[model samples]
Target: MRQTNEEKINRLEELKETYDRFKEKPFQLNLKRGVPGKDQLALSEPMLNILTPEDLYQETEADFRNYGVLTGIPEAKQFFSEVLEITADEVIVGGNSSLQLMYTVLASKMFLGQSDKNSAWAKEKVVKFLCPSPGYDRHFNATEKLGFELIPIEMTSTGPDMDQVEILVANDASIKGIWCIPTYSNPTGVTYSNEVVDRLAKMKTLAQDFVIMWDNAYVVHHLKEKKEHVQNVLETSKSYGTEKRVWMFCSTSKITFPGAGVAALGACKENIDWVTEVLSDQTIGFDKVNQKRHVKFLKDKKHLLQHMEKHAELLKPKFDSISNLFGNYFGEESTMLEWTEPNGGYFVHLTTMDGCADRIVELLADIGVSLTEANASYPYGVNPRNNSIRLAPTSISVEEIEAAVKAICLCVEMVSLEKELDSNK
Candidate 1:
């Protein structure tokens, strides 16, 4: 329903009062990140206590107390292999986080390059990476900090605009990488189509070492009865002799504990060997004792999948609550606002009318409603249209999410109508 200027004026005043009242409540509501809830973390308590003092070493005769394995324990590698659909030999398990693994891989390329035969990336005159906008900020930050100029690419429902991606990569030899969250992508929650992945695998690049950061962090994080799966990226790339071109990663951070979960990287044997050789010089090995803890508890994919079902129960409600609210408040009535209905990811991507998200975010922030900074999902923290806001419903309580998103609806309407009023003049 298009509102008359008079009705909008009255609604604006009412929303301002609502914002003021929320500001006075003196309570903090944080939905700015996709961190798992406390209830989700508690499900992994068995992992911590699973290992008894009696079980100090793994069956491979490797003592967990004294680290010797550099490429992670065999059981953990096999476990990750099962989860990622790559071979155990191709998986390299690491400590607690995938972001760190991703950074280290990028850093290694800068100084060490991909292999002994290749030149260091830092020596390149102009290094660049194609970044799909509305992507993972932490992924962009990893390359940005390393001096690789990030060129933003458009994100469509199927995937990053593959046509643009193809043209840019084909023309720019220096464009060595592109960031992708193929399955249930970060904020938008759309999976890459088979065609997109096929092109990504088959498309040729001048930079022989061109890589794709395939972060399938939410691989098992499904929210519905039926689960969606992406084509086996490693296998697809391998078929095209480009398996080495993709660096696939996932972690139990959200599954178990963010700070103590196990992370893994999967690639062809050549890349895995290169990383292990470099890592051997860096340290004895990662905390195998921690690896043992996880392996002993999760044991296999069945247990892990069952564990995730519990998490889906906790998260589904939060996502549904906010989505329903969006439909109710910012529906067909408004040409100025739209949001994503993600099937199984941690975020809801909301887009207000052009030039309105930042103001809506600021207005909501004034009332103790903290969201992921507007456009934070984009490269360099700039969302050019100034209208995308990532709403994370997982971290906050159901009650808090209800209140926080209602306030967001208020801010979106207020900003959108204010813009409409000015445009009318």
Candidate 2:
């Protein structure tokens, strides 16, 4: 039964006392980013010792200590090919950050265009990129900085609202591209269904040079026994002869070392050639020594999966702790808040009742818990409803997570009661 107004007012007063008590305690806990825990990082420590002086040269007589493999070392390319499920020729292994590769590709398209077949996107009067909401903020920031009008697309359980995507792109010549984290997406943890993937591949766009930025950062980061697989964008696009329109990226940033991991891009042969040609002017090549090191450490896709299972073992408990606490505090029937229980991926997305998220975040901050800014998953850091909060439980200890979560639950109840009390008045 719902509480009477008088009871709610009394409860609010009691909660205010508890809030005052919390303020008296002093501690700092951060959930701002999805960084790997100490234990997770420790798992890859053996990688640093894998290389020796004798292993410095490849069988092809290429000196890894020197330079000259512009695309990538053959072994590195072969390893990424197995990881990306593409041929070695289709992959262009890059530096430690896949985000850098993505930025370069977009910048290239903006100024240079994909090929002579189309004009540069910068030449267009107004260029726009489709961003699926409850998505990655870094992606939105990138496009916005590059001067593209960031159009927000509604994200569903299966994927983006394709009906809207289909209609908008088909009618608007300015809608040039879409950003996708197709499998185990950043905050929401929703994977694109096969049908959604097929539609994206075959969709008719008004822009002849429309692009799809597929960042598969969590492809091997599985938290459950069953591994999630997304339909291959490059292979799917091949049927429609749209392979060049897809640029896929993956990295060992989370797999091994964020600072010195291997990153790669998978695209059509033509696009790979184009990127290779453009990159020749950027630098001699990425650090081949590190590339060779990763190849030695990871060895193959099978070994990569085995390594990721260790990550899952470390991460699964933290995710479970969040889920259990949320359920206990809010209950199955609560309408005040809802959160995702992702099978894989780094974040849990919590959505409070409409108009309450910002207040909750502010309350948490006052007591020294840092969350991703409210509605950060949306483009321009705005969610008109003001209800989304991305929770990152990876970096902190489970004990800290418990304390932080309990504090959050208290704040949720306090804010929710306050909302109802005001509504009744």
Candidate 3:
């Protein structure tokens, strides 16, 4: 039997009444994050076995414990360089998290200043960044922490609106940088098209030191039934003769353990030299032991691809489960709600009727379900539409996902119905 809106609404009311019965109790389930689940961690058990103390502890030419190479081990650099599609010298392997490296890059420019640019960002009258709307909040937070003004740009399925980006960058000398997630972007799971990448590469900015902070966090996490290719930003930069204008960042946080992963920054020689000089003032070098472990575990590109295939296998089912549930619950009433069926990455972006997201989230929380804050994807934690919500299906079990999705749909209906009823009254 097909469930009509009224039937769904009545069902939602019943669920709410039952949920209210337990509102005072503590109920906990965390679906508010995109962290990989336990099954994904199992794939890295081989890494633990690779580096026993008996195997290689001394600081030999081949051994990795004591610090000699500041950039990274030659083999590891060569391997990741291929992954990032840049020359070996252009890549610098840093500590566990890419977020830290990203902060260091910005902070270096703020306090120490870059070679091409003279004024430290802190001394500048107004330092502004072009932030794509509904972007990664942590990126916004990083710039905001440094007192940089964030200007929101709309993000399209293809990429950030290039015309607006080019206009702002070309005209404003204060627009020093932009944040981009080229492949499988954080909340929306959208990739930049070839033309978009090319345009970004060829952009004429007023600021000579204007940088494109490209964070390709989900480069290999494709969820499509067929294989999809992502354009190489570094290559595009070089082709457009704008190699120094782009800085590419990636990490093994999703591939290996998050806290104990290696991060890399790919850029032109000038940018690399500038960053290395500034970085030395802070620390002698990053951990080489973990870098060796990554190389040993993911021996080469072939090995890394094989490992990612395993992750895709585990992840595809979870994505399918949530998508199928959404379709079953809301497919017929498509006029009221909408969501993206992503091909890659760890999220499904959903949008509700205007001003209804906060209500839906609150209703879900009351029923022992948790979600990413309604406006978390936007600048200053404010979603102008107040409709977009990020769904992270990676951290929960299939069974839990089923319950959570069902609860979420009911909450959506409950909120929508209340709004509809209030308007009629």
Provide TM-scores for the models.
Answer: 0.97, 0.98, 0.93
Provide the global lDDT of candidate 1 against the true structure: 0.88
RMSD of each predicted structure: 1.4, 1.2, 2.6
Residues 1-425, candidate 2: write the lDDT tens digits. Answer: 78899998898899889888888884498998888888999998998899998788758578989978989999999999998899999999999999999999999999888766358899889999999999999999999999999999999999999999999999999988999999899899999999999999999998888999999999988999878899998999999988878999999999998888889999999999999988999989899999989999989999989999999999999999999999998899998899999889999999888889899989999888899999999999989999899999898989999999988898888999998888888
Candidate 2 global CA lDDT score: 0.91
Give candidate 3's TM-score. Answer: 0.93
TM-score winner between candidates 2 and 3: 2
Per-residue CA lDDT of model 3 for 159-247, tens digit only, reads: 89999999999899999899999888888888889888889888999988788899988887777666555688778888878888788
lDDT of each: 0.88, 0.91, 0.83
Better of 1 and 2 by TM-score: 2
Models ranked on lDDT: 2, 1, 3
Of the two candidates 1 and 3, the one with more favorable TM-score, higher being better, is 1
Best candidate, lDDT: 2
Considering TM-score, where higher is better, how would the candidates rank from best to worst?
2, 1, 3
Residue-wise C-alpha lDDT for candidate 1, range 392-414, written one tens digit per residue: 88977899988888888888887
Q: Give me the displacement of residue 91 in model 3, in angstroms.
A: 0.5
